[model samples]
Target: MTAEVPTTPPGDAAATREASERGGLPGAVDPPAGGGEAHAASDSALARVVREESGRIVAALTASLGNLDLAEESVAEAVEEALREWRVRGIPPRPGAWLTQAARHNALDRMRRDRRYREKLALLAGATVPTAGEVDERLPLIFGCCHPALSPDAQLALTLRAVCGLTTAQIARATLASATAVGQRIVRAKRKIGAAGIPIRIPEGDDRADRLDLVLTVVSVMYSEAHLVAGRDAAADRDLADDALWLSGVVAAALPREAEAHGLHALLLFHRAREGARAVDGELVLLGDQDRGRWDAALLSEAHRTLESAARLRRSGRWQLHAAIAACHADASSSAATDWLQVLTLYDMLLRYDRSPVVRLNRAVALAAVEGPVEALAEVDSLESALAGYHLWHAVRAHLLRLLGRDAEATAADLRALDLTDNQAERRLIVARLAR
Candidate 1:
């Protein structure tokens, strides 16, 4: 099952409603008008252009305007205008340049009406549109979004919106928050940035290391959300993962000495290598059951080289540790040949940095592979209260129970997992297990 790289994952019912309420997120920006296959092709091209170019354009604008809200609003307006204008004018030879100029003009127009930004208007009037090479301006914008002053939730929301170009609804889905809550956080965050006079400039020296950690965390979350999609629009969902990879690569390039950035890129690439085998014929394939032959050899090789580079740096961050765990699987010729002991060790290291219940749950899975179901079951039982509503916990417990010959309890656990999950593929897998 070859995966289609998506620009945005298809939203749930709530995201759909929010899109309807707000005319649509910038991601859902109207496509070129008209009908027929030709028009459809044009619409897809426009969306691709907008998704690929908008972040850099917005980042460059924010770097100059020193305002996240203004830059995003201006770029969004310009993209919307492009949907209408580009359809008639045909896409410019240099779409990024054209959009930057248009977005700058829009910012200038708005700034002129408000004397509060008279100084900004003067700066923008002379600001040159960033060339292709200058689009890495996202690094500064990322720092601004991940500012320590904001709450972690606010920081994550702002990064996804301002730097990653995810919509409020997309963020809401990813963070498991309501669209209203996510939207409010983004609004409040932008307001705080303005009030606090936060500037979007990349940190230097020691400051760079501290802030890059925050940036990497946000990118990791974005990548995790993008990595697994069962039944959603494959093309749209794939793009979110692609963007995460792109952003992580940019960070690694910008900070060659940062082990965490390289580790993250390696970690994501390792997982992405297996994406092709995650689903088969539109059905979810369990990791152990996936066809290893389908995995991307090129990505696995890159991940190996990247992980080695990060390890050479001698600073083993959480991402690097996680990448090591992924390596245990990637290096295996088959599931039966997997080095479960090595995987278990890496999880131990990961727990030292991140003691979240989710990590513990994952560690329990590795424990089952090494020590037997009884020991792992004990660990899963301890997390019962914490992961009660988390479908995977129940699913893991069910697997353990089945292995232990506790058929009745296994059935009940599977039922609980089925009840808790929204993923159709997961539900189907559980139901099939029950049927068996």
Candidate 2:
């Protein structure tokens, strides 16, 4: 189950806030106070803290415990302890370090209680607790949890749990699955890793390349979720985007020769540059309506530089092509100025590498931009069977039909999209479109 914010009113936000404050699970934090400015700032700060420290904590714990499931359980327990103790004692000067130490103690205690765990305890007994500066040493554990032997779903679950420090429920909300479903997936994945005796160490050379795709996939998923709340939600969410970027940088730094890593980093940077222009006065702003002048010129320049590096590597990957397409849009000052034809070409190239419904839905948008709504409608139509439950597919079709003057059909499609989506903000936007 992906973690998600509950859909209740602000009054219930307090309960959520307490749950998060206690840290028994990932994403149990309280809702931000104040509806407008104060809430946004608080949320942003919280998100930043999570993104920065979660991976380090998870990495350190996993290394110490030598079992993903045990490590996670211990970490969650430590966080819960912190919530209770910190409330009266006050937060430690280094919260991450405190949590890490607490979790390590918890793990050690658990091992001491179980005779079967004695062997693992012996290995960990002499190991020094990790400091903030030593967090990078756990990179191997990050790769191990995201290994390719695991299914994509398993990889995502393990990464969120072991790498991103998210609770199963949070992951459930993020993936639009049930908490039970997500929990089971995490359990099964952990069991598989343990039973398979998958070594918790990074591979070298060709073996590393085999796992690269899985690693990239995890980073991309994190970035996508981060982008969803990039600017619209509290500042805390913005930290999620930053966290994803930081982790991608870690991957890139470790594998500088990997073209796709550079490409993914560039793509995220380009998309992030538009965060400031994505919303106005608490309302969502479509890309077409956003003010180009508000875009981050510095970030845009950095994206271009990364794109150049990816190209110079002489390897063509999905991320490289997608970043190239984003660059096309970024180069344009306005929607009308965009190179739709070039964007369409890039989408076609992306289609060859990725068959994701989301990718197909995006390609349909580019098709509409360059070839008119009718052609785009054709593309959307072809995806109908495959994307029956996807909100964006219907939303795009609704827009295309509206442009084609099919009001009734457009309204039906819009309603369908609205029914399929659970995100309150996204739902409101679709409802408004249908009302129009």
> Best candidate per lDDT, number?
1
In model 1, the Cα lDDT at residue 47 comes to 65
For residues 207-255, what per-residue lDDT tens digits would candidate 1 score against the true structure? 7776777798778777766644433422225776788788889888888
* Model 1, runs deviating above 4 Å: 1-39, 86-98, 131-135, 230-236, 419-421
Encode model 2's per-residue lDDT on 104-177: one tens digit a residue. Answer: 78888988998988988867766665665553555677678877678777777777667765556556645656
Question: TM-score, each model?
Answer: 0.86, 0.85
lDDT for each of the candidates? 0.75, 0.68
Candidate 1 global CA lDDT score:
0.75
Angstrom error of the Cα, residue 272, model 1: value is 2.1
Off by over 4 Å in 2: 1-51, 129-138, 169-179, 229-236
* Native-to-model Cα distance after best TM-score fit, residue 102 in candidate 1, in Å: 3.2
Q: After superposition, how far is residue 107 of candidate 1 from its true place, in Å?
A: 1.1
